[model samples]
Target: MSRHAFFIAGDRVVHVANPCGAGFQYQAQSHVLSPRAQVGPQQHEAAETVLVVQQGALELMVNGAAGYVPAGSFVRIPAKTWFAYRNVGDVAAFVLCRTAPPQPARGARKITIQIAAA
Candidate 1:
């Protein structure tokens, strides 16, 4: 049996059973954010990301629609879509994010948002 365990605390960390495993499946990972920390407007180019709020509350803005993702709430960001997330709560926010078949062009570019008068 393969031993896969690690400490996941304030300073969140993740340990894969097989670091060099080859597959095209999404993996669930835990993440912790400090107050006011944010991530956004990123495109995977190949993989899709889904964020699930586990402990605290988070402000999620996807494709111009805003929603509050609290514990038990989930948000899915399609591959190559514009999206962002922010922790607006008083305390740190805990979230579980899953990604599929790592994108080859990960972080190579960002999605631009433009606003026009209606």
Candidate 2:
């Protein structure tokens, strides 16, 4: 059997696999925030991402609008868009992040044609 690898806390690692042309599939490590732990403006050029809160409440600012994303809530971010989020409560905040192609089939078209008797 092959042994897979994993990391422990304090390592500040990013998991990666299956390199694409210019970028590899990447996942940032999950983090736990203390009361008022915060993150600032950040942007990405790759896939769109979502933040799902698992515990406690979180305040988020995307582009410029402000909103609260609490436990069991998800906030979506468009690719290449600037955004930021922070924990605003007095409890530990947990979040799960996922990235995927936005509008994967937007450029494709669908059509239907009718046949007439001559």
Candidate 3:
């Protein structure tokens, strides 16, 4: 089951159905990153992260192996694997991100004002 959801957080334009709050364990969001932006060589301790480039292109480096993922391409960052992503394209890159076991929220909290359907 899915429900339409929308929110904006930092530089990410998130638009996806997230069932985490309703008690579903896994979480997902469409992350829209700005052009030339780079996400760190971070590692997930518990949940494995799956990222699929929905639009534009992203250079994904997983455990030192790098590959360019264009729209409709996906890469999996296993738990404890170092990974990063950078949008080399001039346009904004959209990535569909899903994490199993629901990753914990970190840093500042942004108010998620739900967008009402018309």
What TM-score, over all chains together, does every model reach? Answer: 0.64, 0.62, 0.67
Q: List model 1 lDDT by residue over 1-118, tens digit each.
A: 1233232333344455533344324456677888889987676776788776868899888778888888777777877777888898889887877766545443344434443434
Instruction: Rank all candidate structures by their TM-score, best first, as comma-separated numbers.
Output: 3, 1, 2
In candidate 3 the C-alpha lDDT for residue 24 amounts to 47
lDDT of model 2, residue 111: 34
lDDT of 2 by residue, 25-76 (tens): 4343355778888876888787787776768888898889889887877788
Candidate 2 stretches with Cα past 4 Å from truth are 1-24, 101-118
In the range 9-118, model 3's lDDT, one tens digit per residue, is: 44345566665565445666667789999887898788898887778999988889888898877777778889999998999997777776444445424444755444
- Could you report the Cα RMSD, in angstroms, for every candidate shown? 14.1, 13.2, 9.3
Which regions of candidate 3 fall more than 4 Å away from where they truly are?
A: 1-16, 102-118
User: How are the candidates ranked when ordered by lDDT, highest leading?
Assistant: 3, 1, 2
| Ten contiguous residues minimizing lDDT sum, candidate 1 | 1-10
Q: Give the distance in Å from residue 92's predicted Cα in candidate 2 to where it truly belongs.
A: 0.8
| Candidate 1: residue 67 Cα off by (Å) | 1.1
* Clashing pairs in model 2, backbone N/Cα/C closer than 3 A: none
**What is the alpha-carbon lDDT of model 1 when measured against the actual structure?**
0.68
Could you tell me the lDDT of residue 58 within candidate 3? 95
What local lDDT does model 1 show for residue 12? 43
